[model samples]
Target: MALPITDHIVAAVSKMVDDSQVEGYREPSHSDIEFYVSRAGLTDADPKAQGQTVGKAKRVRAILSWAIDNDQTAGGKLVESLIAKVRASGGFRDSSANFIGADVIARAVEAFDSEGYILSSDGALRPKNLESLMGRELTVALRDYARRAQKGSEDAALLSGTSKDLLEATAAHVIRTKYGSYPQQANFPALLGQAFIALEMATPEDPPSSTESPYRVMERGMYQSAVGVNRLRNKEGSGHGRPWVASLGVVEAEAAIELAGVIAGYMLDKLDNR
Candidate 1:
C-alpha cells in the first residue's frame, strides 16, 4: 500500500514548480495528467465509467511525475526534496501514484542526456527494485558510485578521470569490504575477478557433482568480461599516460564505466545479502 499523496502534497509540489523559474518548464500534458489521476484511484472505480475525474492527490502526482521525468535538473531536485520530507514523516504507500519517492528519480538529474540507461529512473534501477537489493549498509557506497558515474557520464571529452578510475576504485572497494582484504597491489581486473568469486562463494548453491556449477560458470564468464574492460581502460581509460594522439571516446568511456558500475553493484548487493 502507498501513503496518501494528499492535497498538501499537491500544494507543496506546485510551489516547487513555481519557484524553479526554469524558462519554458513544461506543465503536465493533459493526457499525462489524466493518466496519473486515473492511476491514483482518483477516477470513478466503475468498470464502465464514462468520464474521468481527478482529485488533488492524483493531479499533484501527475505534475510531479512530469516535472521529474522532463525537467530533471530543476524538477528532479524538487521531487527529491519532497520525497525526503515525506519519507522522514513516515509516509510511504503502495500504488505507483502514492510511491512518489525514488532514488533513481532523484539521481537522474545528474545524468548527461536522457537517452541512455546509464542513469535512467526506469528499468532495473527503479527505487523499490534498488531497496529490495540494497539495504542501508550499502547506501553510502552505492551513492558514491552513482556520483562518480555521473561525472563520467557528463564528461564528453573523457578527460576528467571520472569514469574509469571511479569504476576501478569502486570494484576494489566492494571487494575489500566483502572479503575483508584485497591483494595489496592487485590490478582492477584482478580485484574484480576476486570480488565476483567471493560473492559466488558467499551465496549457498547446490554443489556440482562433476561439471562446474552454474555459479562457477557465470562468475568465470564475468571474470573474462572484467578483464576485457580493464584492457579497454588501460588503452583509453583514465589510467597511465598514453601518447597524445590516443584519445578516449565518449562511447568507450561510458561503456567501461557503466560495466564497472554494473559489476560493482551486483557484487555489493550479493555481499550485502550474504
Candidate 2:
C-alpha cells in the first residue's frame, strides 16, 4: 500500500524556518530536500546529480519510513514539532501560496485529529495510523484520544487517561480478532493481560528475564505501562474533581502513547495472516 502523508510532506518540508526568535534560520530549498532524501536512503544519486528521478512522494514515503524505524534520520521530526518550531520562529511564509508552513501544518494536523492518522512523537512527517489494523469502534475511540491529547495541549492527565483507554481498546480489538470473542466487563489492564496470554506473549507469573523473546519483552513493558497509566488516570486524569497530586507530563503521556502503538502494532501484525 502507498505510504501515508507522502503526497504532502515534501511541500511541508520545503519552507524556510520562520523562527522569529532565532536569527540566521535558513529557508529550506530543493537542495535541502535532495540532501535529506539522499541521506534517508530514499535515493542513490547524489543531490548534485542530473535531473531528479525520485518523485517527492517516493522520497517522502521513504524518509518517513526510515524515520519511524530509525531514531537518527534527518529532519524526520514530527510535523507538530516542526509547527512548534515555526511558531516559535514566528512562522514561515511560502510563495507557493499552496504552502505547508506552520499555519497549514497546524490545520492539517487538526484535520486529521479525528481520523486514523497522527504525527509521530518526534514531529516527523509520517502519518501514523491504527485503523488499518484495528476496528472502527477502537479507532474512533483512539481518534478521540488523539484529538484531546494532541501535543501542545496542557491536558497531561487527559493524555495519560486517553492513552490508557486506547491501549485497552486495542487489546479488546486484537483479542476479538485473534480469538473470535470480545472481552467484556474486564478492566483495562486485565483485558490487556488476558490478551497477552492469549497471544502467548507471556504468562501471568513470569518475571522479566534475559531469555524472553522480544515479543515477551514488549508484552511485559505494555503491561507495566498500563499499570502506570492507570494509576495516573485515577490520580491526575480528567473526569476527576480531586486536586492534582501527581506529576504527569506531556513526555510521560507521549511515551505511553508510543508504547501503546508499538504493542498494538505488534499484536495486530501477529494476527495479520491468521
Off by over 4 Å in 2: 1-99, 103-164, 206-218, 234-246, 249-251
**Stretches of model 1 off by over 4 angstroms after superposition:** 1-167, 179-184, 201-210, 234-258
- Pairs of residues at least 3 apart in sequence or in different chains that clash in candidate 1: 1-93, 1-94, 2-93, 2-94, 3-93
State the lDDT at 233 in candidate 2.
Answer: 53
- Taking all chains together, each candidate's TM-score versus the true structure is 0.40, 0.41
Root-mean-square deviation of each candidate, in angstroms? 12.7, 11.2
Span of ten consecutive residues with least summed lDDT in model 1: 123-132
For all candidates in order, the CA lDDT equals: 0.43, 0.48
How far residue 198's Cα lies from its native spot in candidate 2, in Å, is 2.4
Report the CA-based lDDT of candidate 2 relative to the real structure: 0.48
lDDT of 2 by residue, 1-274 (tens): 1233332443443332222333443433345555545554544333235444554434444455445445333434333344444334334334433234556556455544433345432233223333344454354444444443343232322322232344565677768766777658887767877777766667445787788677777667667766665555544344344212356565765665555455555655554534
TM-score of 1: 0.40
What lDDT tens digits, residue by residue, belong to model 1 across residues 69-186? 3443434443444434433333233233333344333433233222221223321122211222223433443654544454444322122323334345445556667665568587
